[model samples]
Target: MTEQALLLVNLGSPASTEVADVRRYLNQFLMDPYVVDLPWPLRRLLVSMILIKRPEQSAHAYASIWWPEGSPLVVLSQRLTDAVRPYWTEGPVELAMRYGEPSIEQSLVKLAKQGIKQVTFAPLYPQFADSTTTTAITEARRVIREKRLDLTLSILQPFYDQPEYLDALVDSVRPHLTQASDHLLLSFHGLPERHLHKTDPTGSHCLKTTDCCQRAEGAVLASCYRAQCLQSAAAFAERAGLAAGQWSVSFQSRLGRAKWIEPYTEAHLEELAAQGVKKLLVMCPAFVADCIETLEEIGDRGREQFIAAGGEELQLIPCMNTHDSWVQALVTLCRRAPQAL
Candidate 1:
């Protein structure tokens, strides 16, 4: 067998809660073309303006969620990689962040130095998105290409609707789903409206009508983030035995004032409270691992909002961090036969 390396990638977090560290992290993350999608000059200006004050606010959130071990997202990602590496005797596994210290370049360099020629990049996002999955792949390729290293790379496809992926998702969340809950809100991260339009092949389907995303098929469904997000939610609902009116979907962690897909998670939480829904179960199917968004935003701030608006309990179902099923599902995704690039 050819020597190989498995590179697991995820959206990164600051090394610490220091404001400077958080600011630098945000700069790298937001500067990516796929992420901000603004022209260079305008993007720089906007990001600069954001950096002036947003870092302090972000620092506080990161502080509140900071685990003793480290950032929960980074820690869980490493744990997943550590578990999977032992199973794959054919290759060693390494974790990389597209925008942090243990970065794509750092991981690639170490592997290249070790004579690793073939690499499989498992972008942790279950859904396809230009910002998350696409950016990670592009950065990996850039480092390999720029260094003129001998490397063979393959990527994991979106597993939002895959059976094993869905099964693992259900397996991880099943323990948390309660018959006493009035509704299950499967919240996903938000992307700006333009992103949906940009990825839409027909340029007519996404944002065309509310019904377009509801019908998940064709190229749009395959690549459109909105479609895949919805698909994951629906599949989880079905597999978890959630009946109609017992489950709903919303988008969370939205940034900067552009219109993102709705219903927004915070607003929806308020609405659910007003509608006499008392017990709400919240799960972030979009994120396989828990992070600041899930821990502090949803678990802390979101819970406060819901209760303040007249709801009893808003429990956050933990993400599939190092769950056995999720780890097994990840191995399946990496070891499965490769698809054509």
Candidate 2:
């Protein structure tokens, strides 16, 4: 039997709340071409400017949510890794971050040393995006080539429309949905409009019409982040028994001057509140773990904004972090991943 291992990768967090640490982490994260998506010179210049003050503000936000053990993302990811380990059965389970410590390089190297012949590279993003999924895949391939590691990688493709994934999402959040909130906002992390066009295999298929995502089919839909998100949200709503008016979709975490996918979460918050929604429930389907984006960005800042906007309460439904159903679902996904020679 071939010795196999499961490796899970996620978006990394800063080593600490310190300004220097946040700056270092942000620099690595933003410098990736897939992320900033600019010419080398222009990207460097833009990121340099962003580094100056964004770090301090980000550091403060990190400080606000930092766990006693470590960054909540790192901690929660490890917990998920631990929970899934026993089920892998094939071999050991390891967790790595796309950026920062415990990187893909380090994890691959460790697996090689353990005499692992076949490894599954799972980028923990349900929806396919060049920035998150592509960068991680590129990094893993880079390590294999540069370091000459003798490991065969079976990559896990995006599971946006996978039945197991949709089922797990609904099962995990059912508890939160039990309470009747005025509305449920399915908020996914926003992507610049250009990203949608850039990833479209059929360039003319995306963002060309008002309902391109709805009309998209086959390859166009496969590469479309927005289409995949909408699919996931709609599937989850149906499985969770949410009515039409009970739930809506929006995009969050817009950065820079670039236009991102709309019904922006920030604006949507106010819209819901103004429409006499006294109680609002927000779920970040973009992230499987509750990181700063879900915890601080939505839970903390979002809650404040919603209440101030005349809403009585705003509650963030936690991600399916370490939930037994999610763990089982993830293992099933990994087992079904196609192998590469």
Candidate 3:
């Protein structure tokens, strides 16, 4: 029997919490055209400026979330790979990162050396983003092209609205909803509004209005993170049997000075607190695994901000990391890839 390979990838973390390591990681990450999407000289200047200060601050943020084994994202990714290995009868399962160490190139090389003929690239981003999934695929393609390998490649596009994914998300959060909370906040990582406008084929797909994401009839919803976020929130709410006004969506993790998709998570926390909505439950559906963004930003700082603004009981429902349902969903995804291709 010929061997096939499956590679799972994610937005990577710095190897260590050291400032220099963080700078190097940020440089590689932010330098990707899909990530920054700016011209060379300008992007270079901007990245350099950020590298000087951002790394130190990022290092501190990472330190808080770092596990004794390693970064939570990488560690959980590896665990997921392990959990899914038994389900892949075709061949071995490996993990890689879109940025940082144990890169996609190295993973491909290892599989190539084993004479693998078919490879599936699963860039584990639930939502499609040029900066995330596209960049990983481009780099994997570049590696295959450079090596002149004979491997056939297939990429797992976004599964933000997939039923299995929705089930896994519901399973992850259902238990937490038992507690009393004013509202359920589904916070996704934000992308710049300009990116959405540029990517919109019809030029009017995303008007940043409340009604903009409610368009479920067209194909525009495929690439719209805002729409997907809302849909996931709805699915989770329905599965959890929550009322309509009991939940809302927001975006977080904005970069640069550009305006990103709103209502921003920080701003929403303030608004909710001011509106006398105490005891909130927050969940980040954008990330399948808990990392710095969720652990530090939402769990720590977000909670502090909510409390400081006159709210109480901020609870963060963790991502579906190494959960049986998530691992099973991943197995199902990989198993169906050969048939889909």
Candidate 4:
């Protein structure tokens, strides 16, 4: 076996909780063709419109959740890297962001300079999507190709339904379940529904109806983000031994007016409160490490909304960041030989 370096990647955050920094981050994030998927000219126009007022608003949001060290996403990702480094005795471990500094390019360059010949890139997203897992892997391959680096690269498969991943997720939430909670909500990041059609290999299985994603098969599961999210939820609930009605799933952080995957997180929070759920346990499975979305959108504001709507307590479960089981799962995922680019 060749000596290999491990690179962990996650969605990025603004450089700082400032308007200029946030604007710069948004530009890089939104300009990705895979993310917006519109024609270049139209995408640029839409992004420009969004930047006009979004930066100020987004900067505030970032500020509300910003950790004293830095963005929670970046900090927690680094912590995960440190935790996994000891296990990866084969080579060094490094962390990168899909949209900011400590970029994939730089991480790869560092590995190359260390005379590492094999690299296994682990995208921190548990479920696959064009914008998240796909884009991160695509960018890494691009850097290798364009830079002419003499290195072999492998990428992690989405671990949504992987037994180890499911088990780790279950372990992370078991302690929470032991506490008093009326409901458990599994929230994955939202993607436009059209994204499924664009990725579906059969072209006829996605969004045909409410049950289509639930019955996804073969290549469908590989590309169907919603189906993978749902799979994770079902597996988790089963492993945790929760009754059918005790837990449910929802999507969060939707952008644009285009129809996104249904059961929005905020709406579900309101619904749970209305249903007289006094104690709610909200878990973010899409993220291995908590970010602004988990900390602010779900923890801070979500708690406020749930209480205002009529709830006693809304507890945001910490993500599987640096957990012993999660670290083991990462090791096993990275241990696989280079399978697909």
lDDT of 2 at 143: 94
Worst 10 residues of 1 by lDDT: 332-341
Rank by lDDT, descending? 2, 4, 1, 3
RMSD of each: 1.2, 0.7, 1.6, 1.1
- Model 4 lDDT-worst window of ten: 332-341
Displacement of the residue 100 alpha carbon in candidate 3, Å: 0.6
lDDT, candidates in the order shown: 0.89, 0.94, 0.87, 0.90
Q: Candidate 2 residues 1-341, lDDT tens each?
A: 88789999999999999999999999999999999999999999999999999999999999999999999999999999999999999999999999898999999999999999799999999999999999999999999999999989999999999999999999989999999789999999999999999988877888988999999889998899999999999999999998999999999999988999998999999999999999999999989999999999999999999999999999999999999899999999999999864
Q: What TM-scores do the predictions have?
A: 0.98, 0.99, 0.96, 0.98
Model 1 lDDT, residue 97, Cα: 91
Residue clash pairs of candidate 3: none
Cα lDDT tens digits, model 1, 251-280, are: 998887899988899899999999999999
Better of 2 and 3 by lDDT: 2
Of candidates 3 and 1, the better by lDDT:
1
- The lDDT of model 4 is 0.90
User: For candidate 1, what is the TM-score?
Assistant: 0.98
Model 4 TM-score, 2 decimals? 0.98
